[model samples]
Target chain A: MTEFEEIKKTLLTIYPFSEEHLKIFTDKLSLKEIKKKDFLLKQNQICNHIAFIIRGSFRLYQKTEQNELTIQFFTEKNWVSDLESLMLKQPSKNYIEANENSKIATISLLDIHNLMEIDSSFSMLNSLIANLTFPTTQISTLKLKSPDKRYEHLLLNNPDWINRFPQMQIASYLGITPETLSRVRARIN
Target chain B: MTEFEEIKKTLLTIYPFSEEHLKIFTDKLSLKEIKKKDFLLKQNQICNHIAFIIRGSFRLYQKTEQNELTIQFFTEKNWVSDLESLMLKQPSKNYIEANENSKIATISLLDIHNLMEIDSSFSMLNSLIANLTFPTTQISTLKLKSPDKRYEHLLLNNPDWINRFPQMQIASYLGITPETLSRVRARIN
Candidate 1:
């Protein structure tokens, strides 16, 4: 099936949205092709759009004085955005980059508002996507003590993300230095 | 105005409802009187309800071997719940406790679903509250280096909460040790 078909399918599964209403909603979406390492969003910019990955993947990260910390990863059938920045209309502190050649359906927060205004189903979908952005930050990180535990947790719960992104990025996501991550990997082996 | 009246006013302002619809809605909520430091939610339990603070404050925290960490604080007019755990129907890893002799309007997730079935206004209100649970987990905490910086961010953005809770709890919320927090406070003074 085409990426757009996958998009429509997910929307339909999210709610049995009427095809006419779905068409009316999806028609407003602008599609984009992003090359690897190209930024979908940058720190200090007010993020205006949220996109759903149709073909590839992206990484969300923050660079501190020490190193870049991976915040989130998004792939096919998943959505990505600096959600708070989009909602608050404030500057973002992270950079979101294409991890592979990617295809996504993009919609601005204004368009989302218009769509929500147009239909209750769209509003419900908006709420679902909002819930999705939240789970990443709500739990873990602060509770976990070691990179080993965090790495194992990721392997158990989100191995797909680990497989898709580079090891260095994974190290960052686990909040450990790359050398430390290498030592952890060797110990595991 | 009474807390119930305040709730009604906020709901009406959020999305206008007919008196009958308001009756259907408010009827699902029960008044809860909580003593200071009483647990509203406990770790490992499924958080069944979301409560709106009517006349007091609450703190959300997670206990670890090292120490108990205060994660979030909620006050009057705010809603509190282990939202993700409630949504997932899973055990929570945090506790929520009253910080005052609080009066709250509490509704179960089942009731929220029933309310959604009854009105589009309830659906919109659910979406609004869902958005509220997200901004906390969204940005800046990991990137900020110093306890001093985090304290300042709190002072600037959430001074009301800082003044309401104990210093040790505030330190935990900042991911800092209390001794360091005291020193930071002394330096500031």
Candidate 2:
């Protein structure tokens, strides 16, 4: 339907907000479109906004002296933010870049705090979302999985990640070399 | 002070709970002492409780055919649980084991849900704690740092981990071998 419709649905799915409260929540969000390869956040910058992807995808990564390591990927309906930076008001050490032309609805940390003060439901919703997206549980286990198992796991859970993102990026996200990913794909095929 | 005084202080530090609410919260918690090498949770079992370490420490880890990988460590005042399992009502794949004789205060998931229903403040507190202990952000970045850098970071942030835990466990937690950890420590010193 509309750009905000997906985020509203997502929010309602997490916690039922009163119509008045929902409107208040949505009113605080601002929409922006970014071109492919544009950065949503960069290392050493504070991430002040939490964004819901309305369209397209993003790669959360970090650059070392030798290479860029992809940590996570977000597609439409998914939320993206450097939670550490946003919550702690500290500079982030990672980068969030658009994988394609993307539209996102974002609310600032201050607005979120204000809303939490305005209504307790907003706080509950924030906690529910945080729990739902608890990355440590998944990523910690994923890091220990074999490359083939990791690829198979991703293939089963989020096939769109495999089909939508480039193989190199996917390999980086999986913490494997392109050659290793190729071998895993070949064996699986 | 008392066993729960630390947890109460920790909770109040996160969100200022009214005396009545704080008492209700503490009243619901049950204290248990676990012996060294005792398990709070095991693979394939559902984790129904989130425990606050009132004393001693724990290592959250996953067992593979070859090794047990330490995913996280929780000492005094730190909260421990398979959050994924507790939130989703699913069996956990990781084990939470006491690294020493430990004392903990635990609340069941059902009790937490009931508390949330009783007071919106409980829900807000849940969200705030979830946000505060957002593990994914830290672990994702930690995975990419070099062994020496990782050890240095840990040394600066939680030197108790270095002083208290066995070198082998610390090495496992760092995703490095005991020998590598030795080299890293030697170079740092």
Candidate 3:
């Protein structure tokens, strides 16, 4: 399907709106191609737009005193945005960068709020966030419970990610050392 | 406000529903009270109900071979139910117990499903999960970046919790040891 068509499909999936309402949202969003290593968001920048990945991947990370830690990776058809920063209109402490040549459609926070006001159906958009993003947040808490179990579960569900993302990034995401990840891989194999 | 009145306000805060719709949900939910240390849910039992804590405090914990860990806690007016175990209809691996005398209202999964089908607004309930419970999840993931930072942030946000919850439980939630937590608290104070 065409990128525009795919975006329309996704919007409808979350909050079904009339054709005109859909057009309002689609019109506001512009698809942009980002080259690998391009920065989508930078530390201390207010992330004004939420990008929906049409093609390619992105990583959200933060640099600590010791290391650059990868917190999450968003691949094709996934949403990647600094939610807290976007919501609070504060400068983001984290960074989001393109991992591969990617195509993403961008929507500004103002546009989303406008759409929510225009489309009553969009009111349930919060439901989408609650269901998709909330559980993901829960996964973080779950990870603290058992790192090895969390790692095993991640591999079981997204085995492809291990090959797609760098080992260092994966280790950061898993809250472990790259050396430890290698050892874990060896043991599992 | 009365417990019944508070339920209406909370429900409407997420989705505006008719008084009739509100009654249907409250009807399915039955109220109960538990003393401190009483089990709301126990390990090895099928958790059949999704409960709302109207008053007091409770926590969900899982025991490892080495230690018993607190996964999460709930205070007044929070939803305290295991989504995985409840949704999957499996025996829970964790136990949820009251930390103090608590008043709760609970509804079975079957009833909630029935309520959803009866009122489309209930389908929008997922956002409630996202906003109310998902932040804890997000914080959990974010904490993986820095355990020390997480502990500091927790203290800043929920000062009373330190006194309310056991030192060991707070340690597990922070992904640290009891000794580390004690030391951290000592340093902070």
Candidate 4:
């Protein structure tokens, strides 16, 4: 399937928009390519577009004075955006980076307004914020689990993330030291 | 204005809907009252309704083996519900309780469906989750501040909650001990 085809399929799966509506949406979308280790958004910049993943993946992180913290990951068939920045029109405190060579279907805030103008009940767009909060569930993980349990929870939820991403990224996401992550893996094994 | 009038007024302020639409939505809402310490929802129970506070306030809490942590607070004119439990139909890990004698205008999930049926663009009903996530901004408080700074934030953002709630509840919400909270207050004074 084409990259556009994957985006259309994914949008349909989430919101069940009709083919006509998907055409209205996809027509406004432009596909963007990013190489590995490049950013879709840098810290303190306004996020200009929302994307539906067609190839590879992306990771969002927050850089504090102490360290860079991984906030979330998005792979093919997922919608990716800095929702707080997009909604509030503020520079985001987070960074969004392409995890590998990636193709993404992108839409600006204006495209979103156009779509909402088209369908008052236009819901797939609403579902994007709901999807964004799943990673905010990470905040709960930090609250609700010990470090070891958090590692186990990450693997159980997204084993593909573990297998595909570098160890350092996963360790940062799990909010543990690389040494601690290695020790946990050894214990689990 | 009556409590119901305030609810109607607040609803219009957030999402402008005609009287006809407001009647369709509000006709389904029943005003319910609760006394201090009674639960709107209990841990492991599904949150079956969303409410707009008519009078008094509420607190959402999480109980572990060692602690009962206050996750959020809601006051008059605020909306309250466990959005995760309401949206996903999962049993919630948190409890919502009245902090004082309280009146609330409430709609069941069935009422929400009825409203959505009336208008496919039925966004006010859709907005309850977005409203719920606003308080989940408390999660950011944990990440962004030390205990003292968190206490300062509580005062800055919600002076009414600090003035109305007991010091213990405020301490719990700030993730600090009562003695520590007292010390912080004394130092400030």
Candidate 5:
């Protein structure tokens, strides 16, 4: 099956969708390629589109007055959208940037509203958004609630992330400083 | 309209649901009464149900070795469920208790899954969980990232919360100490 077909299959696997329902989504979406370091989105810009990464890597981050913090990372077969800014139709305080040259498909919020109105199955799609976003934040929140356990768990679960991301970025994502992370790593080893 | 009707309306407003969909939820749910300081859910027990508070307040917390930390709180018209424990169907690490004498409606996870299968509109219901849980942690994480701004923003946005929640709980939720919150409040006032 093609990437488009995969998109429908992947989405429908998580949500129950019919052919007509899938067609509504495919019709409203456009496939695009983004180069490494190219932005899929930026801070202070309005996030009107929600993009699903078909392949490649992207990181969503926020720039606060003190420093930049990595909120989340997205890779192949994952959806990355600033839901707060996108749903509210406000300027995003977050930036989503490609980490590697990437290809993604995106659908506008207006199209989503239209699809939800036209197709009943799209209601399940809304749940898909909730479920997808919930776990992403849940994992981070779980980690933040208990940084020591989280650091140990992360090493056990996804050591690759340690090697893939910069220490400072990972530190920010973990809600800790680079020095703390380094100390934790050293003690664990 | 009845309280159930209000709930059904809220559900449909976010994602349209049919009569059959609404019936499925009401059929499986039952209203429950909880007294102030009563345990709606307890640590180390399997979280078998999700409760929606129709009246009164509730709090979910975890006990660390040194202190008990408030993970979340819910007022009237809010839902409370241990997402991680509920989804995993494991012994919960947190406890959800009534802050004030409360009346709640609850449904079992099994029943919810049945509802999900029977009608897709329930998916949006799952997404709404974050509406209650995220703000606390999100504010805390923001405070961790940019303490001054988030503190100022919180004071500006919900000045009443300072008076509503205990100082220690507010400080813990903000990932700060009571002394620090006192200092911060002083500076703000």
Candidate 6:
């Protein structure tokens, strides 16, 4: 499939669009190849575009005084953007970096607004994407769970994450220390 | 202003709806009075409606094996619902209960879908409301901050929350113990 087709497939999964609407929507996207470890977004930058991963993965994270915290992870077919920055036009406090050599199809905030102006159906895309991608309920509740429970929840729901990301990053995402994660894994295994 | 008008005003802040569209949207909402400790939703129940708080406050929380974890708080002008449950039609794992006697204007999921079908502009309402209210960025990063920093962040951004809710609920919301919260407050004061 073409890089753009990857985007089309993802959008189709979210909302069925007529061929014409799909064409109009995908026509605005541009594809780019990114090398592993390169940043798509950095701290204090405005996230002006949302990108769909046609290949590879990315990690969204923030750097605090003491450490870098992994906020979320995205892989093939997932859309990545700081929604807060994209919506509010505020500078983002997070960084989005490619985890491996990657190809992405991206559409800018301007293009999105233009499309929304052209057709009201286009407005549903952002919300639908946000709802599907951000498991807000899970994120809010996971923090309240015990370290073992959190690890078990991840094991049950997103086992691939364990194999794909480094242990330190996964530990950061779980809000636990690397040593705690190691102990949890040993206990669970 | 009528309770429905409060909903209208909140919607206007999010998106400038045409007068006709605004009227059609607001007309579907019904006002309900909730006494303190009454639930708008409970665990295992499907959340079929999203409510706009016109008066008083509510807490969205989950009961864990060890404790109750407050996920979020909603006050006047804020919209409240288990978006995950409402969107997916899954049973909610959280509870939304009034902290004080409250009046809310709520529109059912079916009405929202009907309105979206009637006009594409109506589709923007859910996403816009979610974006304005959830503050997903803050929630993700807040977990990474130290307990004292979290309290200071709240004091700077939402001092009213400190005053309105009891120390226990706020402590739960912050994912800290009440004793820790007292120490944080004492240190800051």
Cα DockQ of the candidate 1 complex: 0.24
Model 6: residues >4 Å from true position, as ranges? A2-6, A109-123, A135-142, B2-8, B18-21, B109-127, B135-142
Let me know the DockQ for model 5.
0.18
Give each model a TM-score. Answer: 0.77, 0.80, 0.68, 0.78, 0.72, 0.86
Per-residue alpha-carbon lDDT of model 3 for B85-139, expressed as tens digits? 6544568888899999999998886676555555555754544443334343344
Model 2's chain A TM-score stands at 0.93
A173: Cα error in model 3, Å: 0.5
TM-score-superior candidate, 3 or 5? 5
DockQ of each: 0.24, 0.32, 0.14, 0.23, 0.18, 0.32
**Per-residue CA lDDT of candidate 5, range B1-189, in tens?**
277876776566556778877877777778989998899888899986877778888777877778767766677766788875665556888888887789888888767665655554464555454344544236336526454555776677656666777888777666666887788877877
Q: Tell me model 3's lDDT, rounded to 2 decimals.
A: 0.73
- Model 3, C-alpha of A24: deviation from truth (Å): 4.2
- Per-prediction share of native contacts kept: 0.06, 0.24, 0.04, 0.04, 0.04, 0.14
Write model 2 residue lDDT over A1-189, tens digit each, in one string: 387777778878767888788888889989899999999999999988888899989998888788887878888888888866765567988899999999998888678767766665676455434533667545554556588888987888789898899999888777778999999999999
If you assessed candidate 6 against the hidden native complex, which CAPRI class would it receive? acceptable
Worst 10 residues of 2 chain A by lDDT: A124-133
Which residue runs does candidate 1 get wrong by more than 4 Å?
A12-28, A44-48, A63-69, A89-91, A108-122, A135-139, B2-30, B43-49, B63-67, B86-91, B107-127, B135-139, B179-188
Candidate 5 residue pairs in clash (backbone atoms < 3 Å) = none
lDDT of each: 0.74, 0.79, 0.73, 0.76, 0.71, 0.80
Candidate 4 residue lDDT tens string, B113-169: 656555754545455555565433454565564677878887788888878988887
Sort candidate 5 into its docking category: incorrect
| Top-down DockQ ranking | 6, 2, 1, 4, 5, 3
Per-residue lDDT of B105 in model 3: 91
For every model shown, the clashing-pair count is: 0, 0, 4, 0, 0, 0
Largest TM-score belongs to which candidate? 6
* Sequence-dependent TM-score of model 2: 0.80
CAPRI tier for the interface of model 1? acceptable
For all predictions in the order shown, the interface RMSD in Å is 4.4, 4.1, 6.5, 4.3, 5.7, 3.8
